[model samples]
Target chain A: MTRRLSLFNLTSLIFGFAFLYLPILLLVVYSFNASRLVTVWGGFSTQWYGALFRNEALMEAAWVTLRIALLSATLATVLGTLAALALTRYGRFFGRTLFTGMVYAPMVMPEVITGLSLLLFFVAIGLDRGFWTIALAHTTLTMCFVTVVVQSRLMTFDRSLEEAAMDLGAPPLRTFFAVTLPLIAPSIVAGFLLAFTLSLDDLVIASFNTGPGATTLPIKIYSQVRLGLSPEVNAASAILIGIVTLGVVVATLLTKRSAARARRDGH
Target chain B: MAERSLTRKLTASLVPALPYLWLGVFFLVPFLIVLKISLSDPAVAQPPYKPVFDWSDIAGFFSQLDLDNFETLVGDDLYLSATLSSIRIATISTILLLLVGFPVAYAMARAPERHRPLLVALVILPFWTSFLIRIYAWIAILKPEGLLNQGLMALGAISEPLTILNTEWAVYIGIVYAYLPFMVLPLYAALEKMDDTLLEAALDLGSPPWRSFWTITVPLAMPGIIAGSLLCFIPAVGEFVIPDLLGGSETLMIGRQLWSEFFSNRDWPLASAVAILLLIILVVPIVIYRDVEARRLETES
Candidate 1:
C-alpha cells in the first residue's frame, strides 16, 4: 500500500510540475525564434534579444521599475519589521485589531481598489501622481507581506536570548538591534526580496498611481501586448525568468549555508 | 532618574508605533479618501470630482454628500453584472486551484524528508518570476496560432484551432497559472507539519487509503485550505490584468470595469464608488480570516 502511494505521489508531482513549467518553456523557446511571428520558429536566432536591447522604451521602463522597487522595498522592510515586532512583542494593545486589519487588507484587496484609492488619495492630498506616488503605494502594499513573513520568523525565535540580553543590562532597543535583529535578519531579507519583486512586477496599482513619466516594465508590456503580440515581450519575459531563477538558486544556497552555521552555533 | 526611566519606556512603545502610524496615514487614509470620493459628484474638470468639504459648514458638508454614484451603481446593470461575473470567475478558479493544488501539496508533504526542501523550492521558483511575464507566456500558448493549437493539430485532436484567447477560459487559465503557487505553499506548510502517525494508524486499522485521506487529512488541512482559498479568491475576483489581457468583452469582471471607469472614461467618482462597493463585499471574508488567524496564534502560544 505504501509503495503504491509513493508511485501515486510521484505521478502527481510530474503532472503538476509539467503544467507549471511547459508554458514558461514555450515562452523562452519562442523568444529565440527568428521570425516576428512567435509561433513559427525559423530556426533558433538571437534577433529578439538584439531587438530588446535597442527598445529604448523598455529599457527606460526597466530602469524606472528598478528604482521604484529598491526604494519601496527598503521602506517596506523597515515598516514591516516594526509592525511584526509590534504585533508579536507588544502583545494586545489598543487598536491592535485595527492595525492588524490595515496590514492584512492590502494583501487581499483587489489591486484595482488599492490603485484607485491611492490615486484618489494622492490627488486629494495635492501630491503629484508620479515616481514618488508609485514608491509610496508599493511600500504600503508590500509592507503587509513583510510583516506576515517576518512575524512568523519572530514567533519561532528564541525569546530566551532577548531575556538574556536584557538581564545582562542591555537596553530594550539595544537588545533588538544587537540580538533580535540578527536572529530575524534572514526573514527580513526574505521579506525585502518579496517586496522588491512585487513592486517590480506590479501593473494595476502602479498603473493607477503612476503618471506620464513613470512607466514600469509591466505597464509597458501590457500596452505593447494590447496592441499586438510582440516577440520583444517574450524576450523580456525570458530575461526576467532567468534573473529570478538565478536569484532563487542563490537565495537557497545562502539560506542553506546560514542554516548550517546556525546549527553549529546552536551546538 | 525616575523620569529618565519613564522616557525610556515611552521610547520603547514609540518605536513600534512608527509602522502603525505610517499605515494609518498611507493605507487607512487612502480607504477614507475612496470613501470620500465615492460620496462626491463626478465632474469633467481635472482631478474630477466636486463638493469639497468645509470645516466651517460641517453640517452643510454632510448634507452635500452625494449618494448619486452609489445609486447609479445599483441602477446600472453593467456594475451588477460585472460584480457577479467577477465573483463567479473567482469562485470557480478557487475550486479549480484547490483541486490541482491539493495533490501537488500532498505529494510534496509525503516526499522523502531529504528532498522536501528541494521540492518546496521547485513549487516556489515560478512564484518568484514576474507575474506579468507568466501571464504573457499564456498568451503565447493560448492564442489561435499559438503552440497549443499547433500541438493539437499535430496530434489530429482537432480539425481546426480552438479559439481560447480572448475568452473567459483564457482568464481562468491565466489566474490558475499565476496564483497556483499561492495556493500550494500554504497547503504544503500544513501538510508537511501534519503528524503522519494518524494516517499510519488509520491504515494499520485497515481503512482504505481514500477514506483515510478524506476523514483524516482533509479535516486537519482545513485551515490551510481556507487560507489558500481566500488568498487566491480575493485577488482573482478583482483581477484586472488577466481578464483585460486574456479575456474578451464578455468577461466583464469588476476589476476591468473599474479600470475603464477610472482610466478610459475618467469617471473617478463612479470608479471610487465601485471600489468601495467591492471592498464592502470583500470585508466579511477578510475579517473572518483575521479572526481565524488570531485565534490560531492564541492557541499556538
Candidate 2:
C-alpha cells in the first residue's frame, strides 16, 4: 500500500509540474521557430531575437519600465523598513492595528480599484497622469510587499541586542546603524528585490496611470498582443525570463551563504 | 534626565504614527475619492468639484444617486451575467489551483531537507517572470492553429484543428497557470510545519493511508487552504488580463466591463459605481483575512 501511494505521489508530481510549465516551455521553443506558425517546427533561427532588437517602441517601453521599477522599489524599501520597524517594535499603541491594516490594504486590494482610485485622486488633485503618477502608484503597491518581508524578519529578531547597545551608552541612531541594520540586512535586500520585480512586472496599475508617451513594456506588449501576436514579443519575454531567473538565483545564493555564515559564526 | 527620558518615549510613540499618516494621505484618501465619485451623477458631464463637506451637494448627491447606476447594473442582463461568470470562473480556477498545487507542495514539504530549497525555487520560478509574458504564452498554445491543436492533428487525434483559444477554457488555463504558485507556497508552509506524529498516530489507530490523509492531513491544512483560496479567488475576480487575452470579445467579465465603462464609455461615475460594488464583494474575504491574522497573533501571544 505504501509503495502504491509513493507511485501515485510521483505521478502527481510529474503531472503537476508538466501542467504548470509545458505552456511556458512551448513558448520558449516557438520563439526560435523559422515559421510564423507557432507549431510548424520549420527550423530554429534567431530571427525573432533580431526582430525584437529592431523594434523601437518595445525598446523605449523597456527603458520606461526599468526607470519606474528602480525609482519605486528604492522608495518603497526605505519607507517600508521604517514602517516595519515602527510596527514590530512598538506594539499595542493607539491605532496600531489600523496602521498595519492600511499598510497591508494596498497589497490585497484589486489593482483595478487601486488604479482607478489613484487615477481619480490624481484628477482631483489636478496632477496629470504620466510617469510620475505611475511611480507613485507603484510605490504604494510595492511598499506593502516590502513591509511584509521586513516585518517577518523583525518578528524573529532579538530585541535584547538593541537594549544591550543602549546600555553601553550608545545613542539610538548609532546603535541602529552599528547593530540592527546589519542583522536585518538580508531581509532588507530581499524586500528590495521583491519590490523591484513587482514594479517591473506591474501592468494593471501602470495601464491606468500611464500617458501616451509613458508606456511601459507590459503595456507595449499588451497593445501589440491585442492587435496580433508576434515572435518579437516572444523573444522579449524569453529575454526577460532569463534575466529575472538569473537575478533570483543570485539573490537566493547570497541569502543562503549569509545564513550559513551566521550559523557558523554563532558556533 | 527625566525630561529626556519622557522625550524619548514620545518620539518612539510618534514614529509608528508617521507611516499611518502617509497611508491615510495616499491610500485611504484615494478610496474616499472613489466613494465620493460614485455618489455623483454621471449625467452631468465633467461635473464641477463639490467639496465633500458641502451639505447641499450631499443631499443632491445621495438624492440623485437613486441606485440608477446599480439599477442599471442589475437591469443590464449582460453586466449581471458577467458578474456571475466572473465569480464562477474565479471559483473554478481556485479549485483547479488547489488540486494541482497540493501534491506539488506536499512533495516539496516531504523532500529531503537539502532538496527542499530547489523545489521551492522551481515553484517560484514562473512567478519571477512577467505575468503578461506567461499569459501571452498561453495564446500560442491555445490558438486554433496553435501548438496543442497542431500536435493533436499531426498525431491523428483529431481530423481537424480544435478551436481552443478565445474560449472560457483558455481563461481557466491562464488563471490556474498564473495563480498555482500562490496556492503551492502557503500549502508548502503549512505542510512543512505539520507534525509527522499525527499521521503516525492515525496509522497506529489502523486507519488506511488515504483515509488518514483525508481526515488528519487536510483538516490541519485548512488555514493554508483558506489563505490560498482567498489569494487566488480575490485577484481572479477582478482579473482583467486573462479574460481580455483569452476570452476574446464574447467574454464580458466585470473587470473588462468596468474598464470599458471608464475608458471606452468615459462614464466615470458609472465605472466608479461598478468598482465600488466590486470592492464590496471583496470586503468579505479581506475581513476574514484580518480576523484570521488577528486570531493567530492572539494565539501566539
Candidate 3:
C-alpha cells in the first residue's frame, strides 16, 4: 500500500518486458546468422543483410509503402485534426451520430472488411487499384486513430485561452491557429506518427486494395513468408523494426517534451 | 461587422463538414458498395462482380438482388464454423491477455514514480514496429529446432522439441504478445490513476493484501479491464496475419476464410458477404464503445 517494490510486482514487470522483447531481440540477432536454417546459429554474419538489398521486388514494395505512408499520414493528420475539432468543438450538428459512428467504426472493423468494402468502392467508382487508391484507403483506415489521439488532448483542453483570444478581438480561425493549434500540436504529431506506422505496417487492407506494381512491404513479406521463411525476411524485419523503433522514440520524446513544457506553461 | 460574423460562422460550419463529407464518401459509401456487391453474383468480368441492380430494367434490378450469398453462409458449415471458431479464439485470447496484462499494468502503476514512464514506454515500443515482423519472430522461436523448443530441451524439460509452430497455441501466443501493449496501456492508464489511499485503508482494516486487492484494486481497475478486453478482443476476432502466419491450414478463422474466398476462390460477392457478416457481429461492441466515448466526452466537456 505504501508502494514499496514488492517481489511479485518486480517479477511481473521483468517477465512482461521479457515476453514482449525477447522474440524481437532474437529475431534481430538471428538476422545476422549465416545459417540457411532459421533457428540454427552458424555464427554471426551480415550476409542476409546483403541478400535483402539484392531482392528487387521487396525493395519496390518498400518504396511503394514508404510513399503511401508519407502521403497518407500527412493527409490523415490534417483530416483527423479537423474531425477531432468537429467532435470536440461543434457542440451539435446535423448527422453528428452518423459522423461519430463512421469515425469509430473503422477502428474496430476487421481489416478484411474495410479492405473489401473499400476495394468495392474503388471498383464502382472506376478508380484504379494502385498507389493512389492504397493511399486513400490508408487515409480512411488511419484517420480514426489520429482523431482519437488528438480529441483526447482536445477534450481536456482549456477553452478560456480561445475565449480570451476572441475577447481580445482575434477572429475565430486566427485564434485557432495562433492559440489552440500550438497547444494540441504534440498530440497531432503523435497522431501523424501513429498513422504513418499503421500505413507502413498494413498488410490486409493494402493487400486487398493493391494492384500490380503497388505491392507494399507487408504484402511482399507476407507472400515470401507464405512461400517459406528465409534469412532475408529476418533481415527485412530487423530493418523495419529499427526504423519504427526510431520513430516511436521520436514520438515519445516529443510527447514527453510537450507534456513537460505544458506543465511549465501551466505553472 | 455582420458580413465578417457571417464569414466566421461559415468557417465554423465548414471545418466540421470536411471530415463529414470525407467519411461519407470514403467510409460510409464503401459499406453500401459492399452490401450491394454481397447481393450480386460473382462473374469473370473485369470487376469480377455482377451489379446487384440491373438499372436498364427496374424489375430486373430488383430480381437480380438475390439471397444466394447470404444463403451460402448458412448452408456452408465452413463459414459458420469459421465465424464461431474465430469468436471462440478471440475470447480465449482476450482472457489470456488480461491475465498477463493485468499484472504488468498493476506493477507499472505501483512502480516507483521515477521508473514508471520508462516502463510504460518499454511496453509500447514493440507496438510501433511492424506486426508482421513481430509475428515472424515467433517462427524462429516456435519452430521444432527453434529457440523455445531448443531452450526447453536444453533445460531437460523435454527430450523432444514441442510441436508449437503452425498451431492454434502459437496463434494464441501471438495474439496475446501482439495485443499485450493495447491491453496494458489502457489498464495502466486506469490503475495509475487509482487512489493508493483506498488500498492503504483496506489494509489498515486488517484485510490481507490479496483480500484488499480483490476489494480495492480489482474493483477500481474494472473500467480498465473492460476497456482493455474490448480493445484486444474486437480486433483479435478479425485478425488475419497472426492466424495466417502462425495457425496452420487446419485453423479456420473468418479472416482466413474471407481471404481465401476473395483471393484464392475468386468469389468477390461471397467475400463481401463474409465481411458484411463480420461487421454485423462486431456492431454490438462498436456501438457500445461509441456510446461510452461520447458519454465520457459529454461529462468531460
DockQ each = 0.67, 0.53, 0.76
**Ranking of all predicted structures according to lDDT, beginning with the best and ending with the worst:** 3, 1, 2
The residue-level lDDT of candidate 2 at B284 comes to 93
Per-residue CA lDDT of model 2 for B88-137, tens digit only, reads: 88999999899888988887777677777887888888888889999999
Tell me how far the alpha carbon of residue A267 in candidate 3 is from the true structure, in angstroms, after superposition: 4.9
What are the Cα lDDT values of the candidates? Answer: 0.89, 0.84, 0.90
Compose the digit string of candidate 3's lDDT tens values, residues B1-301.
8998898899888878988898999999999989988898889998898864455799877677888999999999998999999999999999999999999999999898988889988988898888889998898898788899889989999997899978899999999999999999989988998998898888888899988988888888887888888888889989999999999888899988999999998899999899988888888887776666666577656
Weakest ten-residue segment in model 1 chain B by summed lDDT? B292-301
Question: What tens-digit string does per-residue lDDT give for candidate 1 at B174-252?
Answer: 9988999989998987887799899999999999999999999999899889988988888888899899889977789
Instruction: Report how far off residue B178 is in candidate 3 (Å).
Output: 0.7
- Docking quality category of candidate 1 according to DockQ thresholds: medium
TM per prediction:
0.97, 0.93, 0.96
Q: Write the residue-wise lDDT of candidate 1 on A27-116 in tens digits.
A: 998899999888888888899899999999999999999999999999999999989999999989989988988988888888999898
lDDT of 3 at A195: 96
